[model samples]
Target chain A: MRINLASIHVDDQEKALRFYTDVLGFLPKNDVPMGEHRWLTVVSPEEPDGVELVLEPDDHPAVRPYTEALVADGIPFTSFAVADVHAEFDRLKGLGVTFTQEPTVMGPVTTAVLDDTCGNLIQIAAMEAPAS
Target chain B: MGDVFKALADPTRRAILDELQERNGQTLFELCTRLISKHGLSSSRQAVSQHLDVLEAAGLVHTRREGRYKFHDLDTSPLRTITDRWQLPTD
Candidate 1:
């Protein structure tokens, strides 16, 4: 089976769309009206057909507690691969993004965690080549 | 002071302090990541958190709540108790 879709629970769909597209630079892929909410999704501009990220609603009673606990502990809900973690961290910070963890080298990877503003923390990471 | 020595008895707790020394303010997630990746610690997140509690009790680590996020910071003042009790002789 191929993995074509991934999802994150966002507090607000409208706000999530703006952040995913305008702030984080993802392209809109799908938007279907579904009762009180919409089936909203976005794809990376670089890989339009690679994978779709669903902006799922966090209206369920359990979602708030789950997300809040993770946020309180500075745990990210999910991670996105980036070309350069430091560059992305700087760029996001320029746009008023709040980071829970700064760009730090962890063995073979460099990572940073940022607040998505939709009730979840997202991690950005880049793999570094091991020294010979 | 006894609590300080008891807390320092664990290797994982000391590793947490070392990582905090490298970067003063860190989240539990960051500390756990550093311990697993850099120090080869296989402890779970909950275990690391309990270690943090021990450090906090010893006054070697301080936890701060900034808005919705909580951060851990290293504090070495407790170590001074050791120096205050025993003085080194000068040549």
Candidate 2:
């Protein structure tokens, strides 16, 4: 049917929580203790009931290699929609965020990629209106 | 110098050089995105990577690793070989 949940494998749950909430400005949606790791998720404040992002753990053997391979080639694990990619890139850079790719115009979209610090590269993008 | 000519023969490789010229340093992902979006190149990532290898062999592109990420940069010094072989007449 419709998508309600999306997920990203983070190396540490606590660090991910802090980065997602304090830095990236996502609100905590769920945090239930499930043995050693908790079912942690965060939602955009603007869309509280929208898709929740699960901060899954990267404890599995395959996850490290998978994430590392993607990072080595500068590929982003997932992309998030933003209103203005250049403005967000500037704001995030002010807060000590490292961007692998600066805001670049790619046809109808402007995009930037940043290191999440949890073993993943996240892309932020914004659509531009067509030229008259 | 022959390798340079061979490398420059491909349209995709030239496009890669153009993007690198626009922005000196770029990851393979950024190059791929530019090629597909700006140049309408339908080449796969692996294919684009192979093209990069060709460029590197010709000394037109150089790849550097900064920590965990790898970036591709353009170096046009090799193109001087052409000028060295042939000189233009002044009026």
Could you give the interface RMSD of each candidate, to one decimal? 0.5, 0.5
Q: Candidate 2's residue-wise lDDT over A24-120, tens digit each?
A: 9999999999999999999999999999999999999999999988998899999999999989998999999999999999999999999999999
Model 2 TM-score (2 dp)? 0.96
Q: Relative to the true structure, how large is the alpha-carbon lDDT of every model?
A: 0.94, 0.94
Per-candidate DockQ values are: 0.89, 0.90
TM-score to true structure, per model: 0.96, 0.96
Model 2 residue A24 CA deviation in Å: 0.9
Model 2 local distance difference test score = 0.94
Worst 10 residues of 1 chain B by lDDT: B82-91
lDDT of 1 by residue, B1-91 (tens): 3399999999999999989999988988999899989999999999999999999999999999999999999999999887788966766
Evaluated at residue A106, the lDDT of candidate 1 is 93
C-alpha RMSD of candidate 1: 1.5
Q: Candidate 2 — which pairs collide? A: none
Best by DockQ: 2
Residue ranges of candidate 2 with Cα displaced over 4 Å? A129-132
